[model samples]
Target: MRKTVIVQDSPPSVRLVQVGTEQAGQRIDNFLLRLCKGVPKSHIYKAIRSGEVRVNKGRTSADYRVEEGDTVRIPPIRLPRADEPRPVPPASFPVIYEDDAMLVINKPAGVAVHGGSGVSFGVIEQLRAARPQAPFLELAHRLDRETSGLLIIAKKRKALVALHDMMREGGGRKHYQALVVGDWVNDRQHIRLPLLKWLTAAGERRVRVDAQGKAAHTIITMQKRYGRYSLVGAELRTGRTHQIRVHLASSGHPIVGDDKYGSDEVRAHFARLGLERMFLHAGRLELPHPLSGEPLRLEAPLPPACLKILDYLEQHS
Candidate 1:
C-alpha cells in the first residue's frame, strides 16, 4: 500500500459565513479572531479597514456587532501551523440555576470568567468544552479573578442581549460582601466617585478616582465591626471596573486581601489569619428573567475559606 500524506497549511479562499443566533452579539473583529483561528489581530483589523471583509456585501466597522443571518465575507489569510488554537479542556462548575435561556453558577475565586490577558482558558471556554452540544454560552457580565460568587452565563442570543440592556439601564440589583480594613464610621453611606482606568508604566491596568472620570457609585452598609476591620455590604449603582474596590479604598478601608489597593501590613496580618484571597464575594443578585421578565433572585453563600476567615474575625473581636 502506498502512503498518502496530506498537507494542512494551504491558505483558504475568501468565504462568506451567515451569522447564526449562536454566534451573534459579538463584535466583527472578535468574530474574525475566532473564525480565523491562527490569524493575527492586526491582519483582521487591516482586512476590515481595507474593505476586504464585508457584511451583507458592504464594508463594516470592527466594532459592529454581528447579527443573526448577516452574511460576513472573510478574506483568505495564511495561518502558521504553530499558531493553531490549543485544545481546551472541558470543565464544569457548581450550577446555581439553569434554564434554556441562561445559566447561573457559583464561580470560585481565582478563576477568570473568560480567557484572555495571558490566561489560556477560563470558565466560559471550559464550560463550552464541557457542553460540546451547547448552541450558545456567553458571559453576561464579569467578576474579578479574586472575587467568588454568583456569575451569569447566557445560553441564548435573546438572553444575552436582554442581560446587557438590563445591566446598562441598572435594572437589577448586585450586592457584594467585603471585609475591609479600618473602622468604618457610617452605618450606611453612598460613595459617588468618578473613576478613570489607566495603565501603569509597566502596562498594568489600574483605576483611580479622578474628577474627569466616569461616574461610579456604590452603597455601603456596615454589616459588622472587628476593631480594625469592618464587614460591609456593597450595592453597585454603576458598573465600572473595580468600582467597589476603589470606592472602599478611597474611604480608607481597602478590601482585606486585595493586593492592588490594600495596605501591605493589613494584608499580611490577614494572611496570617487564613484570609487567602480578596475579601469580596458576589453574595446576592436580583433581576428580572431575561425572556420571561419575571422577578428572579439568586444567592451564593460564602465559601468555606471565607467563612473560616469570618469565624476568626468574630472570635478575635
Candidate 2:
C-alpha cells in the first residue's frame, strides 16, 4: 500500500511566490493577476506602477516576464468578499461595419469601453460573451464612458498591432461634436495646450492645462449658436484622455453637462431638463484599414438623448 500527501492552498495574504516551469515566460502583471484571486485589475496595475510589487528583492514593472525560479514579492491585497456577483450579460452594440479583419460599433454612452474604476464589466467583456465562438477580439482604442459614438475593435492580433502603429504615427482622423455652454468666439480655433493628469485627494482622476505636461492639440470648428450655447466640431490632433473636454473648459466655454470639468449649476440646470450627460459625441472616424490599406470612414448619429436636448434648446430659446 502507498500513502500520498496533499498540500492545502494557503489563505490570501502577503506572500512570496516562486515562478515554476508552467509560469515561466508569463508577464509579471498577468501572473500576479491570476495568482491574486479576486484582486481587481486596477489594483494590480496600481501596485505595479507604485513599486509595491517586486521581483527577487528588486522593483519590477508590469511587462517584466517571469523566469523559472524567480521569486515574486506580492503585497497583501484586499479581495472582494464575493466573486463578481453577477455574470456579464451577453450584449452587442449597434454595428456600424464588420468584416473579416475588424469591426466598428456605434458605442452608446454610459457604457465603459472596458471595465475599471468600480465597473464590474463593460463592452469588451460583454462582447466576448456575446460572441463565444470568436477566437480573437480586442479594443483598438478607448472611448470615455460618458462619450458616445464610433469605436473600433480588432478581430485579429495582426490588425490590432497594425492599428496601434498607425494611431501612434497619427494616421487616424477623429472628429467630435460637442455643445458648449456659451457661444464660441471664433468660427475656427486651434487649441495647443499641454495637459497634465493628476489625482485628487479623494483619488479621482482629473486633467489640467500645464506647461510641463504632454503636448495636446485640438482644432475647433464652430457649428451654430442657440442663445446660451454653441455647437462645435472638434477635431483631435492628439488623442489624450479628456483632451477635448479640458481644452474647451480652459478656453472658458465648457461643454454642457460635463460634471467633472463644467459648472455644477449648468449640470443641475440640464439635469432638470432631462438632459443628464455631457453633450459630446464621436461623430466621425477616418482610418486606414489595417489589412487592405484602404481608407474607411465611420460615422454615428447623435443619440436620442442628445437630440432631445437640442430640440429643447431650440424650442426654449
Candidate 3:
C-alpha cells in the first residue's frame, strides 16, 4: 500500500494585531517596520499610502500614533528570502540595578543604544533577543554610541512614560566625567549656550553654538589637574545633543580623544597614551523612582581603561 502525499499552495494572508500598552505612542510605520522584519521601508509606506493598512477598520497615515487596544490591519508583504538579514545575536551587559519596573545596565562605549542610521543592531535589540520571554522592554533614554555608563531600560510602559516626563521636566540630575586636553581654570562654572543642530555637506549631524538654537546649560567643576590635562565633572542642567562636548570645546578645553570636536594633535597624543575612545563617562544619575516616586541615586564607575589613562597622566606629570 503506497501512501499519498498531500500538498496545497496558499497565498499570503492579512494579519490583524491588537496594539498593547507597551507599543502605544509609536507611529504606525515604525510599528510595521518592527513587526514585518526584512520588508523594505518603501513597501511599508506604499501600503500605508494606498490605504492597505488600516486601524480600527479605518485607513490611517503612516505617522498615526498607535494606541492600546487599537486593532491594526497589516496587509500581506513579501520579503526577500534569498538574502534575508542575519538574526540579532542575544547579548547582555553589566547590570547596575534591576527591579520590577526597570533594568539599569552599564552600557559600554562604542555600542549604540538602538539600531539606526546604518547600525544593524544595538543594545536594545540584543537585550530583547537575549530575553525573549520579556513582554515589554524599551529605552527610557538614549546615550551616544561613544558614551558609556548607567543606561536605563524600562520594563513596563507606564515606567517608560514616567521616565520621559521626568526627563522633559528636569526632574533628574545627570553627571558625567570628562578628561579634557587643556587645564580648566574654573573651579566651578555654568556654561549656558544655545545649540543649533545642522547637517554637514556629507549629511552628518552636528551641533554648534547659535543664538537661535535651543538653550543648553552645563555645570562644570574641575575635579583634578594633571599638567596640561584636567578632569572635569559635568552636570547636565539642560540636556541637548552633544551639549557637554560642544560647551567644553567652545571654552577651549575639548575632551581628550574626542574626534568630533577635539584637536587632532591632542587626540593623537592621547592615542599614544592608550586612550582610543572618547574620555567621557556618565558616572552618576539622581532621580525619583518612575513608578514609586522614591528618590534614587545610581552610579557607574569609570572603565578600567579610563582609570588607566588617568594613572598614566598622574605618573607622567
Q: What TM-score fits each model?
A: 0.87, 0.79, 0.90
lDDT tens readout by residue for model 1, 1-317: 11111223245777777787567778999777666654667789999999999998999999999887788888788755555454667788999999999999999999988766777678987898788677678899999989999999998878999999999999999999999988999999999999999999988889999999999999999999988889899999999999999999998999988989988887788778877789999999999999999899999999988889888878988
What TM-score does candidate 3 get on C-alpha atoms? 0.90
**Cα RMSDs, all models:** 5.9, 6.7, 6.4
* Alpha-carbon runs more than 4 Å astray in model 1: 1-11, 33-52, 57-59, 76-86
Q: What is the Cα-based lDDT of residue 280 in candidate 2?
A: 94
Sum up the clashes in candidate 1: 0
Which candidate achieves the best TM-score against the true structure?
3
List ranges where model 2 is wrong by over 4 Å: 1-61, 65-86
TM-score-based ranking: 3, 1, 2
Each model's lDDT: 0.87, 0.85, 0.87
lDDT-better candidate, 1 vs 2: 1
How does candidate 2 score on lDDT?
Answer: 0.85
Higher-scoring candidate on TM-score, 1 or 2: 1
